[model samples]
Target chain A: MQQIDASAIDAVGIPRLLLMEHAGLAVVRAVHHLVPDPSAPLVICCGTGWNGGDGLAAARHLHERGHPLRVAVTGPLDRLREEPAAYARILRGLGVAPVECLTAEALGPLDEWLAECRLVIDALLGIGARGAVREPAASMIERINRSGKPVVAVDIPSGLDADTGRIQGVAVRATMTVTFGLAKRGCLLAEGPAHTGTLVVDPITIPRRLLETAAA
Target chain B: MSIHSSLRTPTGVTASLRNVLKRFERVRHLMTQGAWPEGRSVYGLPKIKQVKLKVRKAAAKEKEEAPAEAPATGAAPSSSSS
Candidate 1:
């Protein structure tokens, strides 16, 4: 999947930002399918990776559609990689600054935020995550699960082994998982099925022919 | 000549009828080609299509039997004192 994404960006010349935009738009569409209320309060939890980038972009889309939403980050904004950082900057420019929830105290208001929101978008981790989840992310996952609100996970749920379906220390139990490109093996295996309530295979901007080449 | 006689009534009606039939034929062709039948309105609303997915009964049963166990660490890590 990584190879295909790289090839689509490098060889196929599809911009990473455009791919992220499509992913985010697909996520927004999925959320609309579930919630259907544009006025409902929504919370999007993002990390420092591309998955978080998807959430950041989705936040912008949702905000544009007049949905009352807030973005919560599991880590410092400065730690975000290039693509995600660019999105974060865009969100900031739009006057939608994401709230950092790295510390336990920072997460104090999370419960209240979740209470007011209709659903949460979990963009905390993606297929790249392995080993046991660390620090603030693990705690954020716990809070989100306990919130009792429905969660829509981006790609594979955070802490889930994309191949083995193993839970590395912790994983979010999402009401729906919006995965891009193709379905991950983990989502259909072992504990993965339980955590991922309903799996949605959303398409990115990558050409079908380019994807087929990877399969070959 | 009388005004009624001057009007090309038969030709006008025949021409309109032909146009209507041509539109119907176009719609029939599209339907046969598996295109969604669009509504006559400007919105171009599509006909509702139903799609059903097969459920894996064994998988459903297994999911019910599965335990909701805590993570390996059991407890979340404490924050480092700022």
Candidate 2:
């Protein structure tokens, strides 16, 4: 079987947060396609990296479309470094209040909120965090699944290693995963295909030439 | 058509339309013998229409004269009253 590694696209530097914006847009469109006139609520789980940025962007689009939305972040808002922070700020501007899940205690209420939602967007981790899941995020992933609403993985399932598509013990069972930039290797191989559900590729604005060279 | 009762015809038509469409989809799926049948996944390599054949075989084998055996002991419904 042919296998591609996450390292192949490691150096493919997209503009600061452009990739995240596109990821958010793709998710919003896909959700609309599945439930055109949605009647239930929407819950988006955000992390502290570019993946979180993707969720924040998705929240904005979903809110504008008149879908009831709830945004939850795995860690503290203050700890969100750079791009994700900016994306959070944008969501704030769009009138979305971010709920932080910092401890196990928070999981119950988050689970309750998730239960009321029709769809859950799993942006807790990106392809970059390709190893064992750590801390609150792992528990958050468990709770998201237990809610039983359909999950849409942001880039890859949280706690899932993008390199080998290995689940580092903890992982999100997404019903559909919208991959960013050239379809990550893990999205096609190992247990990745099963855990990811349906794979939808969204190549965020990396120039074709640059993608070819960097991938080469 | 007037909103009083004439419009009810369209409503009835649409309800029947929905039923027809649903039945058509089920029949289409049953005929295809695709990846999933009756909401259950059909694992492994595609084979000939074995499921339908199996059902037919079981039905044919179960055709023992049990009903005749039951009525033979004078338990048949009395038709003299009719």
Candidate 3:
């Protein structure tokens, strides 16, 4: 599987956070459409990096809209790098106290949380994620998958590739995928469609003309 | 050209940008024209510089004054008004 670094986005000349906002809002809209109510109990699974930022943004936007949401940070929040950490702080400010359940023992509440929620968000392993899913994240993915609650995935299904639709170990099975900008070629392929449900492309503020120029 | 047909649209970072900005604009427009109809916005209502009318849904006008419709019906906002 080909790995993608979020820094490579710099070559596109667009702010990564802007992309995350677009991604988060789009996922929010999709989730709103699918769930019976905006306040329907939600369990958001998050990782570090931009994908986590995307999840955090969605949580912020949801909180801003008065949606009832609870975030489960599957990795150590300290494990997060720069930009994402800034966004994580925003989540805390909104009172969406994150459960840093990075291990199976710490994740005992996940099954309970999943059972109580109306929908689950797979912001766990984004496109930047590579290799097999470690402990808590993998187990979390399995629970979210097994729980049968509809999941809205940000970017590619966590653990799936952005270029190839290959999965490393366990990946979140999503009912709807709000992919940023364009539909990644991976989602159009086998493992992608299998993991990703109704694929929706929620491109950010970048100009269409700019994208066309890049293609040309 | 379709969702199932993997004809591979140039997901060049550029095309993705085009689609995203377009959606954001549409969302902003919907917010402005009052597509929610009930006017019960989720807050952070898309603003166009100092014009914030937080009308309750019961008070909202059904016909939102939309910008000129684009040829893209796929991106068109749905009307719940009968």
Candidate 4:
């Protein structure tokens, strides 16, 4: 899968930003499908990687569509990766304030956001993340799970290994998941299926040739 | 006598010896002879017994052909009669 994405970006000349833009759009589509009510409040929990960027992008689209939504960043804006950071900057430009939960203690606001939101979008982690769930994000995941609200995981559930589906500490139990390109190995193995709920594979405009090569 | 007969080919002759053994067969031979040292890597080991294969000349080829030709002639008559 890594090979395919690299080939698509480097060899095929498809922009990474374009891929991320499509991903964000796909997530918004899923949200619209599940919750038709435009006014329903939604919370998007984002990390510092491309996954977070997808969530941030989704927040922007949701905002433009006049959906009442709140976004919480697991870490500070400065810690966000280049791609996700771009989206963060765009959100700021649009005057959409995303709560930055830098420390475990700072995650207190996320509770109220999760409690009132109609649906939660989990973009805290992507396939590239490794090891166990750490502070802030860990507590945030715990809150989302305990909130009992339907969750739409962007790629794979946070804290769930993308390749092994092994939960190092805690993982979100999503009501539905919008996985990009293809279903990750973690989504089908171990406790993945149980945590994943209704799994949806969103191509997100990855080249057909690249997807076939990776599948082969 | 029995041991020599066991080595007979389908044409009723002693099986020809190969000139060389493959690397794995050489290693197995070394292991059986207790010449292979423990904890020693299998790579770049010493060569073992190598028999020089006897290249059959005109006399051997003629002998092989005589039996093969006799069987073909014999089978033809029987097959035709049947």
Q: List the candidate 2 regions with Cα displacement exceeding 4 Å.
A: A1-14, A214-216, B1-82
Q: Sort by TM-score, best first.
A: 4, 1, 3, 2
Better of 1 and 4 by lDDT: 4
Tens digits of per-residue lDDT, candidate 2, A18-61, equal 66677789998778866677566888888888788888888888
Ranking by lDDT: 4, 1, 3, 2
lDDT of 1 by residue, B1-82 (tens): 6576665567565543443332223434455667633422112223433243446887887786664344434444543332
DockQ of 4: 0.01
Single out the weakest 10-residue window by summed lDDT for candidate 2 chain A. A1-10
Which candidate number has the best TM-score?
4
For model 4, residues A68-138, the per-residue Cα lDDT tens digits are 87889988898887888888888888888888888899887788888888999999988888898998889
DockQ score, prediction 1: 0.01
Q: Which residue ranges in model 3 land beyond 4 Å of their true spot?
A: A1-14, A213-216, B1-82
Give the whole-model CA lDDT for all candidates, comma-separated: 0.81, 0.72, 0.73, 0.83
Note the residue pairs that clash in candidate 2: none
Candidate 1 residue-wise lDDT, A58-135, digit = tens = 999999888888899888999988888888898899889998888766788888888899999999989988789986
Query: Deviation in angstroms for B37 in model 4?
Result: 36
TM-score to native of every candidate shown: 0.71, 0.66, 0.67, 0.71
Poorest 10 consecutive residues by lDDT, candidate 4 chain A? A182-191
